[model samples]
Target: MPALDKIRWENYARNLAKGMTQADAYEDAGFTRSKQAASALANNPVILQRVEELRTERERILSGPTVFDEDADTDNGEPLVEVTMEWVIERLAANVVSAQSTGNHSAANKALEMLGHHLGLSFSDKKAPSGDEGKPGSNLGSGNTFNILSLTEGLKQHAAALEQMPMKDVTPEDDG
Candidate 1:
C-alpha cells in the first residue's frame, strides 16, 4: 500500500510537470482533496522532492543521448562532426551534386533514391490505388474530414479548463 501511494504520488508529479495545476494533479492521482489539503500536499517536502525527481526523469528521457564529438575542432583545427538529420540530408544532397558534376550517374541515382525515401516521397507501406481508385469516397479509400488545427485548438481549450478546476474527492470505490 505504501508503494502504491508512492506510485500515485509519482504519477501526480508527472502530470504536474505536463502543466496541470497542483490540485489537478492531486485529483488526477485518485487522491481525495479537502479545502486546502491539496495545497498542503503539494507543499510537502517529500512530495516536492518526488515531483522534482519526476520532472528531471522526464527531461532525461525526452533528451535521449547527447550528440558530442570528443575530437571536436576548435580554432586549433581538428576533425569535427555533428550527427543530425539535417546534416545528413545536406551531405547526401552534396554527394548527389558532386556525383552529377563528375558524371557518376549510378551514384547520383542512388543518392537521389535515398533522399527521396528519407523525405517519404518514395517507398510507401501500401501500394497506392491507380487512377480513380485512389480518389476519396471511392471503394479503395474512405473520405474522412480531418482538421488538425481545429482538433489541436479544442484540446488546448480542454486542457486549460482541466488546469483551472479545483480538486475533487476520490471515493475508494472510484479509486479501485
Candidate 2:
C-alpha cells in the first residue's frame, strides 16, 4: 500500500539516480513524518514540478535518441520523449529474487507505458503470462519480447547502441 507522494517520488528518483532500486526507494526514503509526508509535499507545486523535470531528464538519458521525435512538430514547448532504464532493470532482476517483497504488475505496466510514451511508441503485453498454459508468453529462445535475444540483430546493425545502455540493462522477465 505504498502511496506516491511528491516528496517520496522526488526522493525515490533521487535514490534511483544513485542506482538504488525502486523497492529500496520505497523502504529507504528518509521521511521524518511518513504519515503526513504525502500531503505536505503535495501542497508544494514547485517540488512536484521539480520531481517531474528531474525524472523526465533522467528518463531521456536512459533511452536512445531514436525513440524521440526529432521534428517536434506540434508543440514548441513539448519536451522530448524519454525511457528510463530503472524500471526495466528492476523488473528483469526481480525474476531472480526469491524473497522479493516489493514488486507488482501495475508498477511494471506503468514503467513500460512511460517508456513507450517517451519513445512515441505503443506496445502491448502480447506475451504477458496467463494461467492458461496454451496461451503464448514471452519465451527467451523464441524471441518474443523486445529483449536481448530479439535486439541482437539491431545491436549488430549498429555497434554504438550497445555502448549507450544504462548500467545492468537486460531483458525483463517472461511474466511481466
Which ranges of candidate 1 are over 4 A from the true structure? 1-5, 64-176
Candidate 1: residue 111 Cα off by (Å): 14
Task: Provide the lDDT at 151 for model 2.
Answer: 37
Q: For candidate 1, which ten residues in a row score worst on lDDT?
A: 140-149
- The lDDT of each candidate is 0.56, 0.45
Candidate 1 lDDT over 1-176, as tens digits, reads 12125766766665666768887878887888553766787787777776666566556544654343454542212234546786566556655656776799999767766765565443323433566555553442222123223433533454455457443433246554
Clashes of 2: 1
What's model 2's overall lDDT?
Answer: 0.45
Candidate 1 residue pairs in backbone clash: none
- Give per-model TM-scores: 0.34, 0.24
